[model samples]
Target: MTPPAITGQVALVEDDYTLVINRGTEAGVVAGMVFAVSSGTGQVITDPESGRELGRLSREKLRVRVFDVQPLFARAHTFAETDSFYGLLRIPFVATDDVVTIDVGDPVEAIAIEGMGYRKEANGY
Candidate 1:
Protein backbone atom coordinates (compact mmCIF):
# COMPACT_ATOMS: atom_id res chain seq x y z
CA MET A 1 0.00 0.00 0.00
CA THR A 2 1.06 3.57 -0.64
CA PRO A 3 1.89 5.95 2.19
CA PRO A 4 -0.83 8.24 3.46
CA ALA A 5 -1.19 11.57 1.72
CA ILE A 6 0.66 14.37 3.52
CA THR A 7 0.59 18.16 3.11
CA GLY A 8 2.37 21.08 4.77
CA GLN A 9 3.60 24.63 4.20
CA VAL A 10 7.15 25.98 4.12
CA ALA A 11 7.97 26.35 7.77
CA LEU A 12 11.48 27.80 7.56
CA VAL A 13 13.96 29.22 5.12
CA GLU A 14 17.73 29.98 5.62
CA ASP A 15 18.69 32.14 2.70
CA ASP A 16 22.36 32.28 1.66
CA TYR A 17 23.01 29.83 4.48
CA THR A 18 23.39 26.08 4.50
CA LEU A 19 20.64 24.03 6.12
CA VAL A 20 22.36 21.34 8.11
CA ILE A 21 20.15 18.28 8.25
CA ASN A 22 21.09 15.54 10.66
CA ARG A 23 20.89 12.12 9.03
CA GLY A 24 20.76 10.53 12.46
CA THR A 25 17.63 9.32 14.21
CA GLU A 26 16.92 12.78 15.60
CA ALA A 27 15.65 14.65 12.51
CA GLY A 28 12.67 12.84 10.90
CA VAL A 29 12.99 14.26 7.35
CA VAL A 30 12.71 11.44 4.81
CA ALA A 31 13.67 11.11 1.19
CA GLY A 32 11.50 11.74 -1.89
CA MET A 33 9.87 14.75 -0.20
CA VAL A 34 9.62 18.21 -1.75
CA PHE A 35 10.14 21.52 0.11
CA ALA A 36 9.20 25.05 -0.96
CA VAL A 37 11.65 27.93 -0.23
CA SER A 38 10.09 31.39 -0.15
CA SER A 39 11.00 34.95 0.82
CA GLY A 40 9.30 38.25 1.73
CA THR A 41 10.49 41.56 0.31
CA GLY A 42 8.30 43.88 2.34
CA GLN A 43 9.28 45.26 5.67
CA VAL A 44 7.59 43.78 8.75
CA ILE A 45 6.95 46.86 10.84
CA THR A 46 5.55 46.31 14.29
CA ASP A 47 5.34 47.85 17.76
CA PRO A 48 8.25 47.38 20.09
CA GLU A 49 6.55 45.56 22.95
CA SER A 50 2.98 45.11 21.72
CA GLY A 51 4.34 43.23 18.67
CA ARG A 52 1.49 44.51 16.55
CA GLU A 53 2.10 44.72 12.87
CA LEU A 54 1.61 48.26 11.55
CA GLY A 55 1.66 47.35 7.82
CA ARG A 56 3.30 45.18 5.22
CA LEU A 57 5.96 46.47 2.86
CA SER A 58 5.73 43.91 0.04
CA ARG A 59 5.39 40.20 -0.61
CA GLU A 60 6.67 37.98 -3.35
CA LYS A 61 7.07 34.30 -4.25
CA LEU A 62 10.83 34.26 -4.53
CA ARG A 63 11.56 30.73 -5.70
CA VAL A 64 10.14 27.24 -5.69
CA ARG A 65 11.78 23.93 -4.78
CA VAL A 66 14.99 23.71 -6.75
CA PHE A 67 16.61 21.05 -4.63
CA ASP A 68 15.20 17.57 -4.27
CA VAL A 69 16.26 16.59 -0.76
CA GLN A 70 18.82 13.85 -0.87
CA PRO A 71 18.94 11.16 1.79
CA LEU A 72 22.01 12.41 3.60
CA PHE A 73 23.40 15.55 5.16
CA ALA A 74 25.26 17.32 2.42
CA ARG A 75 25.72 20.95 1.50
CA ALA A 76 22.68 21.85 -0.55
CA HIS A 77 22.95 25.20 -2.34
CA THR A 78 20.24 27.80 -2.60
CA PHE A 79 18.67 28.88 -5.86
CA ALA A 80 18.78 32.56 -4.99
CA GLU A 81 19.81 34.84 -2.12
CA THR A 82 16.96 36.33 -0.09
CA ASP A 83 16.01 37.40 3.42
CA SER A 84 14.04 34.29 4.35
CA PHE A 85 13.92 30.58 3.51
CA TYR A 86 10.95 28.31 3.95
CA GLY A 87 10.88 24.56 3.75
CA LEU A 88 7.60 22.93 2.66
CA LEU A 89 7.64 19.22 3.38
CA ARG A 90 5.45 16.94 1.26
CA ILE A 91 5.48 13.55 -0.32
CA PRO A 92 5.78 13.85 -4.09
CA PHE A 93 3.85 10.73 -5.18
CA VAL A 94 0.83 11.91 -3.25
CA ALA A 95 -0.90 14.34 -5.56
CA THR A 96 -3.85 15.05 -3.32
CA ASP A 97 -1.73 15.52 -0.22
CA ASP A 98 -1.47 19.07 1.06
CA VAL A 99 2.00 20.60 1.44
CA VAL A 100 3.02 22.78 4.38
CA THR A 101 5.92 25.14 3.89
CA ILE A 102 8.23 25.82 6.81
CA ASP A 103 8.86 29.39 7.89
CA VAL A 104 11.00 31.18 10.46
CA GLY A 105 10.47 30.35 14.15
CA ASP A 106 8.99 26.96 13.31
CA PRO A 107 10.07 23.85 15.12
CA VAL A 108 12.45 21.61 13.25
CA GLU A 109 11.00 18.19 12.42
CA ALA A 110 12.38 15.01 10.96
CA ILE A 111 15.92 13.76 10.50
CA ALA A 112 17.40 13.20 7.07
CA ILE A 113 17.10 9.58 5.93
CA GLU A 114 19.99 8.37 3.86
CA GLY A 115 18.91 6.19 0.97
CA MET A 116 21.09 3.22 0.10
CA GLY A 117 21.60 4.36 -3.46
CA TYR A 118 22.62 7.83 -2.37
CA ARG A 119 25.15 6.49 0.08
CA LYS A 120 26.69 4.18 -2.50
CA GLU A 121 26.88 6.94 -5.07
CA ALA A 122 28.43 9.35 -2.61
CA ASN A 123 31.01 6.81 -1.42
CA GLY A 124 31.65 5.36 -4.86
CA TYR A 125 30.63 1.88 -3.75
Candidate 2:
Protein backbone atom coordinates (compact mmCIF):
# COMPACT_ATOMS: atom_id res chain seq x y z
CA MET A 1 0.00 0.00 0.00
CA THR A 2 1.12 3.55 -0.65
CA PRO A 3 2.19 5.40 2.48
CA PRO A 4 0.61 8.64 3.62
CA ALA A 5 2.40 11.98 3.47
CA ILE A 6 2.87 13.82 6.72
CA THR A 7 5.18 16.55 8.01
CA GLY A 8 6.59 17.32 11.46
CA GLN A 9 9.61 18.57 13.29
CA VAL A 10 12.14 16.15 14.73
CA ALA A 11 11.89 15.91 18.50
CA LEU A 12 14.82 13.56 19.29
CA VAL A 13 17.36 11.29 17.69
CA GLU A 14 19.55 8.41 18.93
CA ASP A 15 21.39 6.03 16.65
CA ASP A 16 20.20 2.42 16.63
CA TYR A 17 17.54 3.47 19.11
CA THR A 18 14.56 5.79 18.58
CA LEU A 19 13.61 8.97 16.71
CA VAL A 20 10.67 11.14 17.65
CA ILE A 21 8.59 13.83 15.93
CA ASN A 22 6.40 16.55 17.45
CA ARG A 23 3.15 16.45 15.40
CA GLY A 24 0.87 13.43 15.76
CA THR A 25 -2.83 12.54 15.41
CA GLU A 26 -3.69 15.87 17.00
CA ALA A 27 -1.72 17.08 14.00
CA GLY A 28 -3.42 14.50 11.79
CA VAL A 29 -0.64 11.92 11.99
CA VAL A 30 -1.30 8.23 11.38
CA ALA A 31 0.48 4.89 11.71
CA GLY A 32 2.17 2.92 8.88
CA MET A 33 3.60 6.11 7.36
CA VAL A 34 7.26 6.38 6.36
CA PHE A 35 9.40 9.33 7.42
CA ALA A 36 12.76 10.54 6.10
CA VAL A 37 15.24 12.02 8.53
CA SER A 38 17.47 14.74 7.09
CA SER A 39 20.34 16.87 8.36
CA GLY A 40 20.86 20.63 8.14
CA THR A 41 23.63 20.49 5.55
CA GLY A 42 23.71 21.34 1.88
CA GLN A 43 23.38 24.31 -0.45
CA VAL A 44 20.89 26.68 1.09
CA ILE A 45 17.89 27.47 -1.05
CA THR A 46 17.41 31.17 -0.68
CA ASP A 47 16.74 34.41 -2.46
CA PRO A 48 19.82 36.20 -3.70
CA GLU A 49 18.56 39.64 -2.76
CA SER A 50 17.79 38.67 0.85
CA GLY A 51 20.94 36.54 1.31
CA ARG A 52 18.92 34.33 3.65
CA GLU A 53 18.76 30.55 3.28
CA LEU A 54 15.84 29.80 5.48
CA GLY A 55 16.94 28.11 8.78
CA ARG A 56 20.07 26.35 7.61
CA LEU A 57 18.56 23.06 8.84
CA SER A 58 20.36 20.03 7.43
CA ARG A 59 19.25 16.42 7.97
CA GLU A 60 19.81 12.78 7.07
CA LYS A 61 17.20 10.69 5.28
CA LEU A 62 16.41 7.93 7.74
CA ARG A 63 13.31 5.92 6.99
CA VAL A 64 11.09 5.49 10.06
CA ARG A 65 7.53 4.60 11.00
CA VAL A 66 4.99 5.97 13.52
CA PHE A 67 4.70 3.11 16.02
CA ASP A 68 3.15 4.93 18.94
CA VAL A 69 1.07 8.01 19.64
CA GLN A 70 -0.01 9.69 22.88
CA PRO A 71 -1.92 12.81 23.88
CA LEU A 72 -0.02 15.99 24.71
CA PHE A 73 -1.03 15.92 28.37
CA ALA A 74 -0.23 12.24 28.59
CA ARG A 75 3.25 13.16 27.39
CA ALA A 76 3.49 16.54 29.06
CA HIS A 77 6.68 15.90 30.98
CA THR A 78 8.50 14.58 27.93
CA PHE A 79 6.95 17.07 25.54
CA ALA A 80 7.73 19.88 27.93
CA GLU A 81 11.42 19.14 27.57
CA THR A 82 10.93 18.61 23.84
CA ASP A 83 7.84 19.71 21.95
CA SER A 84 7.37 16.54 19.90
CA PHE A 85 5.83 13.07 20.02
CA TYR A 86 7.64 9.83 20.90
CA GLY A 87 8.14 7.89 17.66
CA LEU A 88 9.44 4.30 17.81
CA LEU A 89 11.03 2.89 14.67
CA ARG A 90 13.29 -0.07 13.90
CA ILE A 91 16.16 0.07 11.38
CA PRO A 92 15.93 -3.15 9.44
CA PHE A 93 17.88 -1.91 6.45
CA VAL A 94 20.83 0.43 6.03
CA ALA A 95 23.52 1.25 3.53
CA THR A 96 27.08 0.26 4.43
CA ASP A 97 28.44 3.50 3.04
CA ASP A 98 25.70 5.70 4.42
CA VAL A 99 26.45 7.06 7.86
CA VAL A 100 23.37 7.23 10.10
CA THR A 101 23.13 10.37 12.19
CA ILE A 102 20.38 12.60 13.63
CA ASP A 103 19.97 15.46 16.07
CA VAL A 104 17.24 16.80 18.31
CA GLY A 105 14.86 19.42 16.88
CA ASP A 106 15.28 18.39 13.30
CA PRO A 107 12.61 18.03 10.58
CA VAL A 108 10.80 14.81 9.60
CA GLU A 109 8.72 13.97 6.54
CA ALA A 110 6.40 10.99 6.05
CA ILE A 111 7.35 9.49 2.71
CA ALA A 112 5.77 6.25 1.56
CA ILE A 113 5.14 2.81 3.06
CA GLU A 114 5.81 -0.54 1.50
CA GLY A 115 2.72 -2.67 1.05
CA MET A 116 2.47 -5.89 3.03
CA GLY A 117 1.65 -9.20 1.38
CA TYR A 118 -1.35 -10.07 3.52
CA ARG A 119 -2.93 -6.61 3.31
CA LYS A 120 -4.94 -5.31 0.36
CA GLU A 121 -7.46 -2.56 -0.31
CA ALA A 122 -10.62 -4.59 -0.88
CA ASN A 123 -10.49 -7.38 1.69
CA GLY A 124 -7.44 -6.55 3.78
CA TYR A 125 -6.80 -3.93 6.38
Best-fitting candidate, scored by TM-score: 2
lDDT of 1 by residue, 1-125 (tens): 42332222343345433333323112333543222333334578998989999876533322232233444432222232223232233221221354433344322222112222212111133
Over the stretch 1-125, how does candidate 2's per-residue lDDT look in tens digits? 54344566677553454667787676655565556666656556777899776655354455566556654300101110012222223334444575566667556665543343222222123
Q: How close is every model to the real structure, measured as TM-score?
A: 0.25, 0.54
lDDT of 1 at 67: 39
Q: RMSD in angstroms, candidate 1?
A: 14.9
The numbered model that scores best in lDDT is 2
Candidate 1 ranges beyond 4 A from true positions: 1-25, 40-42, 45-51, 54-125
Query: How many steric clashes does model 2 contain?
Result: 14
